[model samples]
Target: MKNTILLLTLLFSVNAFADHSTSKFVWSGKCLNSNCTRSEIEAENKANYQKHLQHIQDLDAEQEEEDREWSRQHDEDQARADALPKYQYKPIPETDNCVTRFYEKASSIIGDNAKEYIDVEEIKSGKCIFGFKLMAEEMCEYFDSFSSMATPDWSEAEWCRYRSELREVYIQYSGLVGTSAFTDAVQAERKAKLKPVEDKHHKIYQNLYEQHLKQLKQ
Candidate 1:
C-alpha cells in the first residue's frame, strides 16, 4: 500500500512540472521567453520602449535642423535678387533751337527738285557740252548753282557736311580729262559763298552744343 501511494505521488509531481513548464508569459501583447519570470520580462520591455522613444526624438531633431538650413538659404537667395540694379528706357525729346530754324529754311530751298546738281558725264556725252574744256566750265557753273541754294542762316555743321560731300565728288574727277580748272573754280566759289556766314554761325553752333548738353542734364 505504501509503494502504490509513492507511485501516485511521483506521477502527480511530474504532471505539475509539465503544467508549469508549458505556461507562457506574454510581453507587449506577444509570447516571449519561456524561462523568464514576469518581472524580468516587464523590465526588458520598459528598456526597449525607452530606446524606441530616444530614436524617434533624434529623428525629429535632424528633420528640424534640415528645415532651418533650407529656410536660411531661401531667405539669402531672395535678398540677393532684391539687391540687383534695375533699368528703364526713355525717348529723345525735341527742342526749340537754331538747328530747327536751319532745317525749316533748307526745306523751302530744297523742294522736289530731284536734279539739283548736274552730272558732268551726262553733260559731256549727251552733246550738251561737247569738248573737255567746255564740259569743265559747265561743271563749275553747275557746282556754283547748287551751292547758292544754301542760305546764310544755316549752321556750320550743315555747311561742313554739304561741303565734304561735294569735295568727295571733286576727288573722283580731279584731273584725268582736264578737270583741274573745274575743281579749282569750284573750290574758289565754295570759299567765297561760305566765308561771310561761316565766321558768324560756326561759333554760334559750338556754343549751342554746350547749351544743349546742359539742358539734357536738367
Candidate 2:
C-alpha cells in the first residue's frame, strides 16, 4: 500500500513539474515571445529604428557627395573651356575686283610717263611690270594714297596681290631714288609705317589658311 501511495505521489509530482515548465515562458533566442518584457521589446525596437534612420542618413550623404563631385567636374570642364583660346573671325567679304582698281589707280598716277617707265612688250607678253614707278614724285604720291586708305575688306587673294604690288612699287622707287641719306631716311620711315598693316594682313591670311584646312579635314 505504501509503495502504491509513493508511486501515486511520484506521478503527481511529475505532472505538476510538467505543467509548471510549460505554463511559464522561457527565452528561445529567436523571436520575442511572451517571455519578453515590454521594456526589452521597446528597447530592441528603438535600436532597430535608429539603425534604419542611420542607413537613410548614410544614403543621403552618399548621394550628396556624388552630386558635389558631379558639380565639381562640371565646373572644371567649364573652366578649361573658358581657358582655351577663342578666335573671333570676321566674315569673308565679297570679291570687289580690288586688284584691278589698284592697278588702274597706279596707271592713272603714271599717265603721261607710262611710256617711259612701263615696258609695253612686257604687258603684251603677260609679264607683271605694271607696279614699276620710275619717278620719285609718282612713287611718293602712289604710296601716300595707298597708305592713307583704309584697309579693304578684301579676300585673301586680293590682299596678296595688293601686297605684291606695293612691294614692286617700293623696289622700283628705291632703285630710282638710289641711296642718299634723305632717301634712306624716307625708306626707313615708309617701312616702319607699312609693317603693322603687313602684319595684320599676314595674320588674316594665316587664319584663312587654317580655317580652310579644317574644312578640308571635315
Candidate 3:
C-alpha cells in the first residue's frame, strides 16, 4: 500500500510539470506558447514604435531640406530680377540742323501748289535738295554711332520710334522728289538707286534690335 501511494504521487508530479512546460498564455489578445514571452512581445512593440518614429523623423528632415532648397531658389530668382535693368523712356534728340531744315522745307513743299509745280531742275538745285543730302549723311553717321555702342542708351520704344522717324524722312523725301506721282517703273528705278544705302542701314538696325531683345531676356 505504501509503494502504490508513492507511485501515484510521482505520476501526479510528472503530469503537473508536463502541463506547465507545454502551457500557452494570452499576449496582445493572442495565445502564445511558453517560448513567446510577454517581455519579448513588449520589446518587439517598442522596436516597431522606434522604427515608426524614425520614419516620421526622416520624412520631416526630407521635407525641411526641400523647403530650404525652394526658398534658396526663390531668393536667387528675386536677386536676378532685382539685378535686371529697369526701363525708362528716353526720347531721341532732334538736334541735327540739316534734318530740321529738311523737315521744314518738305512740309512747305507739300502745302504749296506753286512750289510743287516748279521745274524739276529748280527742285534739284533748291535748299530742300541740299538739306536732303545733308540729312542722308547725318543718318549714315547716326547708324555708325549706334553700331559702335556696346550697349545702346535708348530703350526699345525709343529705338522703334527712331526707326519710324527714319521711315517718315524717306516718305517726305519721296514726296519732295515727286516720286509718289511717278510711274511704277520710275518708282522702282528710284528704289533701286536707294537700295544699297537702305540695306546697309537696315542691317545695322537689325543687329542692334537683336541685342536689345537679348538684354531684355537677361
Best by lDDT: 2
Instruction: Compute each candidate's TM-score over C-alphas.
Output: 0.29, 0.28, 0.29
Name the weakest run of 10 consecutive residues (lDDT summed) in model 3. 114-123
Deviation (Å) of 185 in candidate 3: 54
List candidate 1 stretches off by more than 4 Å: 1-34, 87-218
Whole-model lDDT per candidate: 0.47, 0.52, 0.48
Write candidate 1's Cα lDDT for 166-207 as tens digits. Answer: 565556556643645656767676566567555555666777
lDDT, residue 37, candidate 2: 60
Q: For each candidate in turn, give its C-alpha RMSD to the true structure in angstroms.
A: 23.0, 24.4, 23.0
- Model 1 — TM-score against the truth? 0.29
> Which ten-residue region of model 1 has the weakest summed lDDT?
123-132
Query: In model 1, what is the error at residue 160, expressed in angstroms?
Result: 21
Q: Stretches of candidate 2 above 4 Å error?
A: 1-36, 92-218
